[model samples]
Structure formats: structure tokens, C-alpha cells
Target: MKFTSGPITRPLKMGAYLKVSYNEKRSQVISWEKVNKNDVPTKALAKLQ
Candidate 1:
């Protein structure tokens, strides 16, 4: 699965990262994960291993 940060604009609103897991039919999401930047402090975001 892949995850990406939400829409970001100037002034900073501290968005979030979204990821959706699909089921066998792929008609609906089976599970989801969300991580908010609100608690991570406003800073430059980067990739990690």
C-alpha cells in the first residue's frame, strides 16, 4: 500500500497522510490509516525507509 500527504496550501494548516486498503472486489475500502501532522510540529516533510 502507498500513503501520501493531503492537499497543502500556504500558511500551513497541518494536514494529514491518507492510505486506503481495498478488498477483493475493490469496490470499497477494507481499512484506512491516517497520520496527522498537527502533532509533529510544522516543518519540512521528507521520505523515510
Candidate 2:
């Protein structure tokens, strides 16, 4: 994991952020706020199992 700034070709707020995660065979882009939501976690956990 790493944190980097700049090289953004657009404008956004401070809390507006994105996350990219890659496993051995898959990759995904996730929004910070959306993924951290209380409702989202419950729904996601149910689907995972």
C-alpha cells in the first residue's frame, strides 16, 4: 500500500478520494466514502459468505 499526491488532472474536494486494490488475480477501484458506509458493509458481508 502507498499514498501519493498530485498528477491529478482534475479538481476534487479533500475527502473525495479513490482506492485501488489488486490481489494475485484481480483488481478493483473503490470510492473511499462508499466503501466505508455502514449499510454497505453489512450488505457486502452477507454476499461474501
Q: Report lDDT per candidate.
A: 0.49, 0.43
Q: Which ten residues in a row have the lowest lDDT in candidate 1?
A: 4-13
- Give lDDT: candidate 1, residue 34: 64
Model 1 regions more than 4 Å off = 1-14, 24-26, 36-49
Candidate with the greatest lDDT versus the true structure: 1
In candidate 2, which residue pairs get closer than 3 Å at backbone N, Cα or C atoms, i.e. clash? none
**Distance (Å) between predicted and true CA of 13, model 2?**
33
Per-residue lDDT of model 2, residues 1-49, tens digit only? 3443435544444443343353645553332332333444566557655
For model 1, residues 1-49, the per-residue Cα lDDT tens digits are 3333345432323455544577877676667666565444344344421
Clashes counted in candidate 2 amount to 0
Q: Model 1: number of clashes?
A: 0
Number of clashing residue pairs in every model?
Answer: 0, 0
TM per prediction = 0.33, 0.21
